[model samples]
Target chain A: MGAPLTTRGNAPKQDRSRATRRRLLQSAVACLAERGWTGSTVAVVAEHAGVTRGAAQHHFPTREDLFTAAVEYVAEERSAVVRDLPRPAGVREAVEAVVGLYTGELFRAALQLWVAASNEPQLAPRVVALEARIGRETHRMAVRLLDADESAPGVRETVQGLLDMARGLGLANLLTDDGARRERVVAQWAAVVEAALRG
Target chain B: MGAPLTTRGNAPKQDRSRATRRRLLQSAVACLAERGWTGSTVAVVAEHAGVTRGAAQHHFPTREDLFTAAVEYVAEERSAVVRDLPRPAGVREAVEAVVGLYTGELFRAALQLWVAASNEPQLAPRVVALEARIGRETHRMAVRLLDADESAPGVRETVQGLLDMARGLGLANLLTDDGARRERVVAQWAAVVEAALRG
Candidate 1:
C-alpha cells in the first residue's frame, strides 16, 4: 500500500506527509466499505487512521473532500492492479481476471460510495466524474487485455459490454452469493468475445 | 396500474382495499426513486398516496413491510411489462427492447431500493429474495424472447450475460447519462448474439 515517497517541493517533511495522507485515505476506504457513506464520518476515519481529528481536518477540510480524495486514491490503486496483472493466455482467463477485479474489495468500497453519492447532491457531481474517469481507464484495460482494435466496427462496444457485464455481476453479488453463476456468465461472455475478435 | 378486483372471500370491500394497497405501493416507489430509502418514511408515503396515516399503518404496520412490499410490487409490474412486450422480428430489435425495459422508470425506481438494501441489514435478505425471484422470471422471459434453449452448450449463459449487461447499463445510467453509449453496447451485443446463434 506504500508508494515511494518522492519529495515534491520540501524535502524534510514530504515522506511523513505522504504517509499520513495514504493512511487517511486507506482508512476512509475501509470505513466506507464497512459503514457506508453516512456512517463513515470524519472522526471515525481519523480514529481509524490513528490520527488526531485536527490532523484529519488539516488534510481534508470537509467530509466531501476526504471522500472524494479517498475515491480517487482507491481508483488509482485498482488501476495499477489491473495494469500490472500478468497477461492472460486466453479469453477465459482474461474474463476471469476482470470479473475477479470487479468482485474484489475495491469494487465493494466504490459501490458503497456510489450508492451514497446517488442521493447526495453535494457528492453526486464528484462521484459521477470519478466514475467516468474510472470507466475510461477500465475500458482501456479491457481493450489491451483483449488485444482489440478500437477502430474496428464492433470491437469497442463489445469490450464495453464485457465491462458492463462484470459490473452487473458485481452488483448481483452484492446481495446474493452468485459466484458459481458469475463464473458461467464469464465463460460464455469470453467465448462470445473470442468469436467477435475472430470475425 | 390497476389489478382486477377479485371477490374470493369478501365481496364488497375487495376493490377498495386492493386500490389502497396499490396506491401505497406506487407511492412508496415514487418516494424511493425521488428521495431514497431514508427519506421515504411511512408518513411521507401515506401523504403521497393520499391515504390517511391510520390506513397506511393498517396496510403496512412497519417500515420494512412497506418497503418490502414496494420492492415486490415494482418487480411484478416490470416483469409484466417485459412479458407483454410484442415479440421482435429479430435479435437486434429484441435486444433493443430489452435494453429499453431496463433503462425505464421501473429500473430507476428499483435501483434506489437495491442500493439502499445493499447496506441495510434488515432490508438485505428481502432484497436478495426479491432479486432471485425477479432474476428467474427475467431469464425465462429472455429465453422465450430469444427462442433459446437452456440445455444447449453456452446458450443459457449468453442469455444471462445479456441480462446482466442490461442491468449494468441500467446501473450506470443511474448516475450518468449513458443512454447513447448503452445503445451502442446493445447493438454490438446483438451482433455477437446473432453471430453466435448462426454458428
Candidate 2:
C-alpha cells in the first residue's frame, strides 16, 4: 500500500490536486471491489483513474497510503449515504434500510479490503484501526436511525447483534445469492429487536 | 492448490500414505492460520509437514487440492468437537457453548480459508458449497441444543440470526481482541432467545 505523499515543490493548484486525489481514491475502491487488494496496485489505480503514474504517486506514494485513503473515503461516503436516508418509521423499515446499507457496493469493497488486510502484515494495523472506527460509527448511526433507547436494558447488545448479523449476511452474499435467506434473517432480527425495545 | 494425487505405482504402505496425508492436512491448517492463503504454498506446507516434496505431491498435486482437503479435514474435526460437547442445561449455557465453539482455532482456520476463497476463483465454488453445508448443519445443531420450537413463528429466523451473529463475532475476533465485547453480545442475545422461547 502507498504512503500518503507529502506536498512537494510549489503546491500544485489545490483544487486540481484535490480532484486528482479524489479520482485516485475512487479508482482504488473500484479496483478493490472488482479485483481485490493484491490486484489493485498503484499503477492499476492510476490507470483506472486515467492519471499518470507520477500524478498518482504525487497523491499516494505507497499502496498502503492508497488503500488507507480508499477505506476512509468509502467509509465516509457510505456514512453520508446512511445519514441521508430518511429516518425509518418502524423497526421493520429500519431493519430493511440498515440491511440495505450493509449489502451494497460499499460493503463489497470493504470486505475485499478486510480480507486483504487480514493477511497482509503491513496493512493489518491500519485496516484494524479503520474497521474499529467504522464499526463504532456504524453502530451509532444504527442506534440513531432505529430510534433505539440506549438506556433500556440489553438495547446496546440488541443493536450490536443486528449489526453483526448484517455483516455476516453481507459476507454470505459475497459468495452466493443469499438475498432470500438474508431477508428472512433481517425480518426475524427486526422482530427480536422490537420485542426487546417493548420489554 | 494440489489436486488429489492418484495412486501411482504400487501404493506405498496404506498406513504410511494415510499418515502423510493427515500430516499434510494438519500442516496446511497451521499454515493457513499463521501464514494465510497466499503464504501457505505447497512447498511451505510440505516443509512444515516434514514430508518430502514428492511425498506431499503424491497426496496433493495442486495447491487448491491441498487447501480443499485441509478445509474438509478441519470442518470434520470441528463438527466432531461440537457433537461431543455435553448438551447445555439451559439456553444461556447453550449460547455459551455455541459461542465458545465459534471463537476457537477452528474458526480462525476456517476464516482464513473463507477469506482466501472469496478472492480465489478456483476455490470459491468449493468453499461456497462447504459453507452452505456447514451452515445448515450448524443451524440444525443449534435448534436441537436450544430445544427451539421449529414450528413457532420466527423460530427459524431466531436460529438463523443467532448463527449469523456468531459468525459475525467470529469475524470480528479475527481482526481484533473482541472477547469481552463478544461475551456481552452473547449474553444479551441469550437473554433475548430465552425471552422469545417463553413468549
Candidate 3:
C-alpha cells in the first residue's frame, strides 16, 4: 500500500502486482504447513502460486525473505482478526476463539520456521526475535479480548498458561487429528480461566 | 540390558559393548539437543562419545537407527523414573515433577527429530508412531501420578491440558530462558489442575 512492494512506475500494473505478492505469501504459508521447510523452495512456492519464479523472486529476493514475509503477513492478518473481533459472548467462546488462532496455517507455518531456525545460525536470532514479538502482541490481544485483569494475583500467568496450552494443543495436533480431545480440553481451560480470573 | 545391543556373543566384551552403546545413545541425545538433527551424525556422536565411527556403526548402522534408539532409550528411562517415583505429597509437587520431565535433553532431542521427521517421508511415519506410543504412555503415567479419576467430567482433559501446557512451556524455553515467566505459569497450572481435578 505504501509504494507497492513488487514494482514501481507502472501504475496500470500496481493492483496486479499487489495481488501477485499476496498469492505468493498465501502459497508460502500453505506450502509450509503442508510440506514443511524442506519442501518449501522459492521455485516450488512460486509454482504453487501460479506465478513465474521470476515474479516471486522479484517480490522476495531470497528464500528467507519470502518465508519470513509469509509468516509476518499471516501474523498481521491474525492481529487484525483479533482487533476486529466482536468481543466473544462468554468465557468459553473467548477461549475457543483464542485457541482457534493457534490451530490455523499461521501457527503451523511459524512452528516449521521455529524448527528450521533452531539449527540455522542466521535464522535463529531472527526467528527468536520475531516469535517473541508475536508472543507479546498475542498476549496483549488475548488479555484485551478476555477482559482479563492482570493486576489481579496470578492473572497474568493464568492468561499465559492458556496461550501455552493452546500452543501445546497446536503442536499435538500437527501429527494427528486430536479434534475431540482438543475440544474437551478447550472447554476445561475455559472453566479454569474463568475461575482463576475470578479469584 | 537384554542381550546387549552393540555386540553379540562376546561374553567378555559384553559389558564394554553395553557401555559403548550407552555412551553413543547419550551422546546422540546431547548432540541432537546442541547441534540438532543436521549435525547429529553417527560419526559426530561417536567422536563426542570418545569412540570410533566403526564402533558407533556397530551399535547403530544408520542415522535413523541411532536417533530412534536414543529417543527410545530416554523414553524407557523416563518410564522407569515414573514407576520409581515416590508418591508426591501434593498436587504442586506432582505438577512440578511432570513439568520437569519435559524440560530436559530428551525433549529437546525429540523436538529436533520432530522437525526433521516432518519433512522426511522415510522418517515421518515411524516418528509419528513412536511419538503416539510415547504420548499415551506419558499420559497414563501422569494420570497415575496425579491420582486423577478419569471417570469424572473433564478430568482426563484437565490432566492432558496440564501436559499440553508443560509441552508449551518446553517449546517456549527452547528459544530463550523464560524461567521467571515459566515459573509463574507452572504455579498457575498447578493451581488449575488442583481445582479442575477436585470437581
Candidate 4:
C-alpha cells in the first residue's frame, strides 16, 4: 500500500518538518496494520517512513504519542470523508451516502485502528472517544436529514444502531472474502436505516 | 481475579486439575479486563489466581494454550446462554430474548474478552471464528423465528442487521454510566427490532 502522509520518502522536499510528521503517522498505521500494536516501535515506524528514528522521535516523543497521532489522523481522514458529502437530494441519498462513507477505505483504516485500540488499555479510551465523536457527528447529520429531534423517542437508538451495523459490516467485510455478501449487507443496512428514518 | 485452569489456588479440592484450569481462565479474564492484553502476563494471572508460577505453567503449557482455552471457555458460556432460550412465543419475545442476551452478563464478559483478543495476533483468528460462529447461530435462530430461508430477499440481511444492533447496544450500554439510560437503550433496541420484524 502507498504510504499515507506519514511516509517521509513521499514528502515534498520543501516541507521537511511537515513531511516527517506525516510520514511518522503513516508509518505507524502501516506498522499497526501489518504487525499489530505490540510489534510496532519507533525504530520500525521510522524505517517504514524512510526516516531516522530521531526524526520519528522529533514528531512523536513516545510510542503512545505516535499512536495517538496516528489514530487522530485516521479519525480526521474519516471525518473529512463524511463531512464532504454533497447535500443529499433526499432522505434516500443521505442514507446511501452515510453507508458509502462507513463502508469506504477510510473506514476500513479506522476499523484496523479500532481493532488495535480495543486491546490497548491506554488507547481504548481515545478510540472510544473518537468513535463517540463520529457517532455524534453522524447522528447530527441523520437527525438533520430526517427532521428528527434529539428528544424523539428511539431516534438516538436508531441512529446508534445504524452506526453499529455499519461498523459490524466493515469488520465482517475485513474478515471475510465475500464481496457479494458485503454488498448484500450494505444494502440491508440502507434499508434498515431508511425504514427507521421513514418511521 | 482468577487463574486459567492451570493456576493453583483457585483449583477445586475435589478435582485439583479441573479446578486449576477453571481458576486460570477466570484469572485470565480478570487480568485481561483489568490490565488489557499487552499488560497482562502469566505471572500476573497466576498471582491473581493465588497460584505459583510453576502451577500456572503445569496447567497451561504455553501462553497461547492458556489464551485459547480462555477464549473457548468464554465462547461456550455465551453460546450456552443464547442457545438455552426455548422457542419464543412470538417475534416480539424472540427480539426481546436476543436483546436481553446481548445486554446480559455473558455478552459483557465476552465483549471484554473480545477487546483483549483484538490486540493479540495469535488470538485474533480464534476470536473471529468464535464471533462468526455466534453470528451464524444467531442467524439460524432468527431464520426460525422469521420463518424465512437464507435466499429469501432481506432475510439474511435483516437477521444480520438485528444482530449488529444488539451488539452495538451492548457496547453502548457498557460505555454509558446512567442506569436509566441503559434501560432506555434496551427499550429502544426492542422497539426497533419489533418494528423491523413487523415489516
Model number with the top lDDT: 3
Over the stretch A1-199, how does candidate 4's per-residue lDDT look in tens digits?
A: 5557676565556477887788888778767755656677889889989999887887788787887678568657656665666667765566555555555445544555554564566767776777677667767766665455567567786665566555555545544454577566657666666666666
- In candidate 2 the C-alpha lDDT for residue A128 amounts to 89
- Fnat scores for every prediction: 0.67, 0.55, 0.59, 0.33
Tens-digit lDDT string for candidate 3 (A88-175): 8889998898788788889889988887787778778878888888899999888987889989888898999999888888888776
TM-score of chain A of each: 0.90, 0.89, 0.92, 0.74
Q: State the C-alpha lDDT per candidate.
A: 0.82, 0.82, 0.87, 0.65
Give the residue spans of candidate 1 off by over 4 A: A1-12, B1-12
- Give the per-residue lDDT digits (tens) of candidate 3, residues B1-199: 6667555577658788999999999899999988888778888999999999998998898899999889888888889988898978889888888888788889999988887887677887878888988899889888888988999888888889899888888888887778898888888888888987985
Tell me which of candidates 1 and 4 scores higher on DockQ: 1
All DockQ scores: 0.66, 0.51, 0.59, 0.29
Candidate 4 lDDT score at position B174: 55
Q: In model 2, which regions exceed 4 Å deviation?
A: A1-12, B1-12
Worst 10 residues of 4 chain B by lDDT: B173-182
Shift of residue B28 alpha carbon in model 1, Å: 0.9
Give TM per candidate: 0.91, 0.91, 0.89, 0.73
**lDDT, residue A33, model 4:** 57
Can you rank all candidates by DockQ, best first? Answer: 1, 3, 2, 4
The Cα RMSD in angstroms, rounded to one decimal, for candidate 3 relative to the true structure is 4.0
Model 1's DockQ score: 0.66
